[model samples]
Target chain A: MLQGNCEILKREQLTETIFDVTVSAPEMAAKAKAGQFAQIRAEGFFLRRPISICEIDKAAGTLRFVFEVRGGGTEALSRLAVGEKMDLIAPLGNGFTLLPQGEVIVIGGGIGVPPMLGVALSYHGRAKAILGFRSRSAVILESDFIRTGQMPVVCTDDGSYGKAGVVTNALVEQIALRRPDLIAACGPEPMLRAVIEVARKEGIPCEVSLEQRMACGVGACLVCACRTVKNGEEHLRHVCKDGPVFPAEEVLL
Target chain B: MNRLAVTVAGVTFRNPVITASGACGFGREYNHFYPLSRLGGISVKGMTLRPQEGNLPPRVAETPAGMLNSVGLQNPGVDAFLQDELPWLEKQDTRIIANVAGHTVEDCEEIARRIEGSAVDMIELNISCPNVKQGGAAFGTSCMAAAEVTAAVRRYTTKPLMVKLSPNVTSITEIARAVEAAGADAVSLINTLLGMRIDLRTRRPILRNNVGGLSGPAVFPIAVRMVWQVANAVKIPVVGMGGIATWQDAVEMMMAGASAVQVGAAAFSDPMAPVKIVDGLAEYCADQGIESISEIVGSVHPWE
Candidate 1:
């Protein structure tokens, strides 16, 4: 990981509460992989906010991250403008590991869809994406996923979007149509847990990205620890360092 | 350049800024951001006799200007450190302080014995960790227990022994004096104050451990007061910590009677805080026209 000043190349409001920002950080853009995150420092906030890498433009030396205005820290971050310089610790935590030859199925929920954009792009049209949102208005990055993946499915809870119900409903239908060799997902804890269950029943290998309230984006403070079972024993693993990503079966969630 | 060197128990440090235990891990994670040698010292994550997985999830809660953590001293055990982490740490041009924690005197003694003759510059007995179920804060709250643990570890090692004292005690100076009398080379205080936070929406405690150690800007003044009291009562050197974030806070800590200061929770928010403090101290000394940074140690003069 590296710490440097990133200049905002572009900033846009994806939704009322969500923002999509592209920043010029060559070093980070070069080194960052899919599912990794950056710790962003905002003006007047003591803590650096951790946001996942939504997409990357290596040729242009820029990276895009989507964030929601959760509280004061993110509120300050959303106010950043073009040409503004921000301090960031980038390419942190373990990223998703890609498999060689397989029909990959990607599942994302709400803000989780952003990280999957990078994953879909990495798979080079061999991946199918299932995105879930609360409603049509909360949808984000649907066109980006479609541009990268094959047969991108967008679902909403209130049936105001492409498909009704949840991403899992689409995931179950997709599994029956074509059995994917692997599954990669990022979303809320409950959604991830449901995705893992389907992957396990279908015998498809799955990896998940977890979210935790972290103090230090590095492995140090152990503030972002999550419980996992490994070798028949349960232990605490740091979400910032050991993972924001882990094999779905290994994580208790 | 202004002289920022500090010698605690005969171990010389390039500066007076040390990364407090539990905040920096074993120095590998932070090393990716900057060189570890840029700071004066690194008190590694608190270690135990055997590997510990620490507490359950939801172990941290952010409060106003600070945070509460109940990590429970999770570490890879002493043998793992000696085999895996020590070689890399020894190469760094900074003082290495092994922060040891245990449940009993034997546990503390065994950890010290294992680390003896290793590359560590000092052994910081973590007698004040407040998050554990046993042996940590229990020893720190009592003068006798603190001294006993210090003497137990002191018997097994020739390295400089620094007892980390907790702020939860009734009298911090009394505990400092007790550890000093027990042949401790130096003392570090105050470990995070015992605290807890509740989630209003859930109507439940935020941390899984319920009460964790509180550190950050909120605990700065309390740490300075305890450091001054302990420094006045003990002849051995004092390493002050708790809520130290900036160079001004470091200088304030030194003036209040700390030979060195450890940046703890603040490092979580800003990874460069300790290194910045080191640079900030030199600038302050140069601007003040002070030849030696030691001139500020215990220089606070209270009106009679």
Candidate 2:
């Protein structure tokens, strides 16, 4: 909802492909929520890259962004250093919903792990973080989850890390041990589909963050169309406006 | 004289900046960035007789300074626009031009007729949309077909009618003149040029539609040249678009004979693009000591 040339307060190359940076955008940080995203402008690119807010440091007046170098846009973005200014349209799309005084389980997959951090932190000490990565080196933000006043359960596909399977495996294991009030996630469509199915079977409320090719991130362009069902009928929703996040039942896929 | 306002087809705009069809939607989303009243006008999403779901993703793809979209005129039906969006747009203190697209002449006329009794200010006949299978760029690529649809819609509406021209045609000026002869009060060009992009890994077109209309800085020069040609070909006002991103692009477009200009894909980069162009025009006019921004229209003295 705000445009500012925020200065990069810190930057770290989490891995060769992933990046972690925090920007000084106080007003946007103040208005930001756990599941929202920021459309960061890369120099010379026509479309701004949509990066999910990994963490919101309201006291420090900064918001953390974590992303992988997917293509040209993110490749250009990954090259920026600390002290550089990046133009951003922040706190966009709907964020995950939180319940009052209830234990929650936050699940994330690969790059999808970032969006869940803010929600996990909000429920600090009472929240559980189960993350899945392609391998151990691809893993990120373990220490940050520890900052949430809890130890995280990390899983790698190669079994080079904590658990030897996907986050759904961790999710099912955790769900059976003790039921959490809610589950929230963001990741690949197939993975989200699996997570949604598991949540539905368990009768647990869930919200997921979706991604789409977008232009006019404000929803005026209608490029980022997401399909969902309402009242026994299918409807087209704007991922940029209606949500990057939606309830598990409302989403069609 | 007002510095930014310009008259098109006897209708005065508070500014020469309008958001092109398919760019600003119905002014509902961009309203969060800034007030819509600051714009001279907004051409809402292209509408049909019934609601359209538009093309499936990926509907847009980035290529250099521009982007391509095959949105395929997704919109709520005309009746829904009149009932749901028109009232909210009317309260915004900006001109509302309903952009109508149809598969046939009757379809376009029906939409125009429905807008006749509403608070809408004008009707922009969209014969240039490139994504649809029929009646979009098909009617626009031919002079006779463009004229036929223009004349049909003209008979149905008392509103000032503007025909939007497609750049995919052989001679754009011929289509512009044909629409003019068929009772078009004005002409807006150029709609996105037909373009395609493929991913090397997938070895398939990036957009779901395979091809889309390209807009942005990459197409600005073509738009300027076409606007100049069409502006001279027909006596009707020329509302130019395509890559009118920066304030400088607006000045260059106006100098090429556009009475007004529309900001298209550029607004996606920055929602305040048109508003910034409005302020930039004021600054440029003041510094140049020009009394009216309209004074610069077609003022480019080309070398002999």
Candidate 3:
């Protein structure tokens, strides 16, 4: 990983509380992968905020990060203007490993949809995407997912948008039609649990990206540990180093 | 060039900035960011006699100026550390201070015996872990219990021993003096202070364990105070830690009577923090025209 000052190239409000920020970080963007995250240092905050890489533009030497203003740290991050420099450590954590030449179904919920955009763009196979949001106004990166994946499905809980159901409902329907070789997902715990349940029932291989409140983006601190079973023995794995991404069967979700 | 080297006990470190235990796991993870040889020493994560699963999730919470963690000594045990982790760590060009924790006196002695002739340069007895319910804070909070544990481990090994002290105690110097009397070669002070945070919405504790150890800039002043008091009370060298983030912090810690300082929570904000302090100390030495970095140790003079 490398630490450098990233110049904010652009910032846009994706929704009421969510934002899309593009920063100039050639070294980090060059090595960044789909599921890996960057730790952004905010002024007045003691710890760096860990945000996953939403998109990587290698040619432009920039990276896009989508985050919600959930706490003081992100609120500080959201206040940064264009051309401002922010300290960052990037290309952290083990990212998703894409399999070649297979039908893959990608499921995402809320803030989780942004990282899937990177995976969709990089997968060298038939990739389909299912995005779930709270309402029509909460939907983000729909057009980007459409441009990158084969078939993009959008769903909302309140029937305010396309399909008017959860992402897992769409996942189950897609699994019935053409059984994807792999299922990849990222989102809140409840949504990830639902997706994992469906994948297990269908006997489809799956991978998941986990979110944890972290201190060190590096593996040094055991702040982001999650339970996982390896070879029948349960162990606590560091989400920052061992993975932000792990096989569905391996993780005890 | 000024002599940055410091000889604590029998082993000599190239510098005086070691990565605090529990912050830097087994030296493998942070090695990707910078070479391990650049550090003065590395205190590997707290190890135990048996593999521990640690505390339940939501193990960390961010406070105003620091973070609290309740990772209850999650480790692969001594055998695994010797077999799987130590081989890789032995190759690194730095001193290895193995931080060991236990629930009983035998557990402490057994682990000390196991690592006696191993790759580790010294054994740092972790009697100060506040997250665990047993053995840790129990032994560290009292002078008698702290001395007993230190003496027990001293009997099993010939290697230099450093007892890591807790900041939660009423009299830190009392425990420091007790450990020194029990044949401890050195002492490291101010392990995270016991603290808790509550989630107002849920009306419940933030950590699953309800209480955790707090560390970062918030605890730096406490660490300095404790280190100064312990340094004055003990004859053995004292290693200071707690919220040391910058090169200036390191210098201040040395003046407070610490032979060396460990960088802990600061590494979370900047992966290069420890290395930056190491280089920054050299620059400070050169600019101030100090012949040796050791000259600043315990140099603070208060106007009485």
Candidate 4:
């Protein structure tokens, strides 16, 4: 992993509480993979904040980050203007495992949609995205997902947008239409549990990206640990190092 | 003469900046940023007799100029360190100080015996971990308990022993003198001070353990004060640490009577923090026309 001040190439207010930033981080963008993250240092904050890599454009030497204003740290990050510099530790955490040639269904809920877009881009036309949100205003990255040559299946809980329920329903419908070889997802724990259940029952392999309050993003601090099982032995794993992404079978969540 | 070198407990460090234990885990994560040899030494993560799972989530929380961490001595056990971690770290061309922690004097002695012939350069007894339920800071808070654990482990190992003292104590000098009389080679102080942060919304504590050890720039003054007091109280060498981030902080710590210094929370804020301090110290030494960096140790002339 590399740590330095990467120039902010672009910054956009995606919604009332969400933001999108692209930075001129050649080395980092070149090394970044889907489901991985970057720890961006906000001015005056003790610990750097961890945000997932939403898009990695190697050609432009830039990485796009989409994050919600969760606290003082992220709020500070959202305020930086273009032409500014943001200190970052990049391409951290273990990313997703996508087969070279296979159909995959990517499930995303709310802010989790950004990371799925990176995974979906890897599959191009072969990946189907099931995006869910709280309402029309909360929905984001619809057009970005479409740019991957696939019309994303959007779902809203209040029926303010696409379908009238959660993404799990859309997932079941799409599964019956065409059985995907693999399932990739990122979202709240309940949604992940439901997605893992569907993948387990259908016998399709699944991988998930998890989130936790973290420090020393390189995994030395052991602050972002998750209880997981492997080969019948349970152990606490660092989400930042062991993975932000893991095979669904290994995660206790 | 080595400009930045300072000898502590018979071991000659290339510099005086060692990465504090628990802040840098086994020297693996930060190795990608810079070579481990850039540091004077490394105190690996705190270890116990058996693998410890640590505490629940939200183990860390930030505060004014500092952060509270209640990791509760989570480690892969001392055997794992000797078998798996030491071989890799010993090859890093830097001194490795294995930080040992446990719930009892017997526990400390048992781990000391296990690592009696290991590659580590020293034994840093971690008796000031405030996050654990027992035998952590509990052992360091009292002179009798501190002396008991220190003397027990000193009998089992021939390696240099440095006892880490907590700032939460009423009389840190007494504990420092106690460990010194018990045969400690040196002392490193002050470990994080016990602190708490309550959540305004839930009317609860932010950390799952409710309290954690506090460290960062906020604790620098307190650490310097304690280091000054302890250095005066004990005849052994002092390795000052706690909230030391910049080269200026290192200069102040040395002037306060620390033979060497360790960088802790500062490394978390900047991965290259320790390396940067090493570079800056050399520059400061040259600019000040000091022939040897050790000349600055205990140089502060207190007016009081």
Best candidate, TM-score: 4
Report, for every candidate in turn, its global Cα lDDT versus the true structure.
Answer: 0.91, 0.91, 0.91, 0.93
lDDT of 4 at B47: 95
Q: Model 4, range A147-231, lDDT digits (tens) per residue?
A: 8788999999999999999889999999999999999999999999999999999999999999987879898988787888899
Q: Write candidate 1's Cα lDDT for A28-132 as tens digits.
A: 999999999999987776668899999978899999999999988899999999999878898999988877777899899998999999988888988999999
Specify the poorest-scoring 10-residue window by lDDT in model 1 chain A. A41-50
Error of 2 at B133 (Å): 1.4
TM-score of chain B of each: 0.98, 0.99, 0.99, 0.99
lDDT of 2 by residue, A1-253 (tens): 9999999989999998999989999999999999899988988799899899999989888999999999888998888889999899998998988777788888889999999999899886778999889898999999999988878999999999989988898899999998999989888888899999999999999999999998888888998888888888888788988999999888977
Clash pairs of candidate 3?
Answer: none
- Scoring model 4 with DockQ, what do you get? 0.73
What's the TM for model 3?
0.97
DockQ of candidates 1 onward, in order?
0.72, 0.79, 0.77, 0.73
**Model 1: lDDT of residue B273:** 84
Return the clash pairs for model 2, or none.
Answer: none
lDDT of 1 at A217: 92
**Any runs in candidate 2 off by more than 4 Å, and if so which?**
none
**Which candidate leads the pack in DockQ?**
2
State the lDDT at A164 in candidate 1.
Answer: 95
List the candidate 3 regions with Cα displacement exceeding 4 Å. A149-151
lDDT of 3 by residue, A112-222 (tens): 988988888887437889999999999999888867747589999998999898899999999888889999999988999999999999999999999888888888888
